[model samples]
Target chain A: MEDQKPTSILVLDDEPIVCKRLKSALEKRGYEVEIFFRSSDAFKRITERNFDIVITDLKMEGLDGMAFLTEVKKRSPATEVIVITGFATMETAKESFQKGVFDFLAKPFKLGEIQDAVERAEKKIKGNIS
Target chain B: MRILVALDTNRYSQYVVNEVAKLAMNTWADVTLLGVESRKPASNGTQPPRNLPIVRKLQEFREEFLGYFKDESVSPYAIKRWGYELVDRGKGLLEEMCVCKGMKDFRVRIRFGQPTKQILTEAVEEQSDLIVVGCSKGEQCTWEQDRNAPEKIVKAAPCSVLVVKEEKKPTKIVCCLDHDSVSQESLELINQMVTLHQTDLALVGLTESEHLREEVDQKMKQILQYYTAQKIKAWVSVVDVSLLDKFIADTAEKGLIALWMGHKSLIGKFFSQDRVGKLVRSAQSSVLILR
Candidate 1:
């Protein structure tokens, strides 16, 4: 199968550095990457149906990663969600997994690890869409 | 992309630094130059001593390696302030060299403990996209008492690990479709790297016997056609098991070799251990074992 278009990725992080780093890395890999520092802005973009994958930081000021993912999945079940949390606990990890999150990574994770998770999630999206 | 480079007292680590500098500049990636020193007892168990002298080995290598590098901006202000020996020097040199190469998002991190453990831990904490580590000549390339640091990191790292034997620009990106499956994961990963590097693609198919040749050839065509549909053209070759080693070495010289990785893979298991360590080390370019 051929994807005529590039994969669209939405990255949400409270930390600007995290968003910028992920944007550059994923952009280099040919994904159209957009970064958002505010959860409200990210939530708006998700409802607009722009991105194929949503990578959100678990801990945020307004909307936390879990609630954000849950809301995204409810409206757009096909959209893949990958949650990254710096303060990962067993309970939160389980909750995200049960919520059908594509993958949950503990913070200070490797960029490669996140990339791999995104690729795996992309396959699921392709399967769902096709 | 978050890229962590592990610099040590070895001269080869300089090559890793240069390679990272050029790569980070081209990719606009965030770079972290990490130097891990052996955990030694602080004479007072409190503050470190001032006026840290440069490690003789690190100094010697820097002079020799930098002699060819025309960048005069590679200074060690942090090292002069931190008051440590070789490792602090490594951290400063790597950061300075990256800055000289026009990289803006670069930082130096120094840790005192087991090098492999600290490097791996940092890769996790920083969420690095890639880990570039340099191994010394022979098997002596280790962190503290940890044996096979290179191989261990290659296996244990959560992200992709690029083991640099010597610094050279990649001419081609090689992807071996030797697995029984359609290689969906491997192909997807390779596609990303290929897009980023814009290097030539060489797909190698391994057939155990003559009867398997037709199937491998057919799969090769399918993969090639898939790429073609995506507007990416690639060359394909079918090889017997006996010629696999030579095939890898020959392909590695161009740029990168992407070998399918798993515990069961003959190729991955071979290169991930000491059995084929020399083969990988001697390759002309960098090695990326996709897991």
Candidate 2:
């Protein structure tokens, strides 16, 4: 028998409230979570270590979410990236899906919605491994 | 925060609901969906029938608004069922209605009278923090019956008002700050708008004279610092008080124009009531009158 490693998630949004709430909610659900308010910092951390899942915002200050997620996929194809944005459009959603994003959620969404997204992502991650 | 959404049976009103839903969900504000019908009640003061076209349309609007929050297992503003009571005040039949209760209030109401007067009265009675309304796009923002309803609400609202023109998304929010008396609530509202649009923030401060540049700069710096701390991409510039009007007109075409006209705000003094109404009608983009 071997000890199992908990699922690790990295959440990035320029809005501190979004980051904080995601971190708290995800942690409560038995997941290890780290949050960043800057895309640059999140990118640096991503380059350092790969996480099981990544949740990001489309619009950010220095480096936008789309570019950051592309780099994440380039490094680790298995890591699922879920995008949550305040300014959502059909074009952005299509582009995100084309880039192989796991899920897309709009801002002002209830906590339950993200949790469901995370659960679905987890199932897909587990399926790929099995 | 309480939000009063004044709607008419038009395409303009249909689009405004989505905008209001975004704001309401973010702020968790108590919301009231108001519909005004330009009809006269009977002389006997009898209540209007429940199946009037306007009432049915209002119910449809309510459903559309609630659709935005449907996926959640436990809704924040939970609604049970539609309920209404007909109360006849002096003016006409005022239907005070609600669809049950939740942590926050979501109500659908109907009024019979003039559009502008009814909307204004609802704002005052609900003690709403903001009013969200829409008008036609182009040179004139005409309602179904009233042509200048949106402009009148912006000019006479006791609280802040958001006039949504076209469904165009703003690339930036240009907040014109003329004084240091901006309220924290107003700033938070601007932050929400910036986040909603995923746009940059441009702060324009007013300077009366060459020597006043330093003072205005200092004030702008303070406000700029606040947004910076919030991790919002923001910048500031000082405009001569004389050129403020021209600056706003130029910027309004591209971004949302947010004017902080609090009670003690100098911007209120600069832009008179008539001027405020004119700005609301003439701006190419949407306008946010922060009171």
Among these predictions, the greatest DockQ belongs to 1
Residue lDDT tens for model 2, B1-291? 568999987787877888898766555556899988788545444566676777888889899988877844334466433456554555665767553545357898988889999999998877777899987666677786688999888878887889887676888998876655676557767766886687999997776763345555676787888777667888787677788668877887788889877753244355667777777777766789987
| Interface RMSD list for the candidates | 14.2, 9.1
- Model 1 lDDT tens row, B9-75: 6566777877665443233345677766666445564354322221444444444433433432321
Error of 2 at B194 (Å): 2.0
Go through the candidates in order and give each one's C-alpha lDDT.
0.65, 0.77
Global lDDT of model 1 = 0.65
Most lDDT-accurate candidate: 2
What is candidate 2's lDDT per residue for A1-130, written digit by digit as tens? Answer: 1127788999999878778988999999999999999898999999899999999998787899999989999999999998887655545655776788877665545576678779878877887887
Return the lDDT, model 2, position A75.
Answer: 98
Cα deviation of B36, candidate 2, in Å? 2.0
Q: What lDDT does candidate 2 reach at residue B95? A: 65
For each candidate, report its DockQ versus the true two-chain complex: 0.04, 0.04
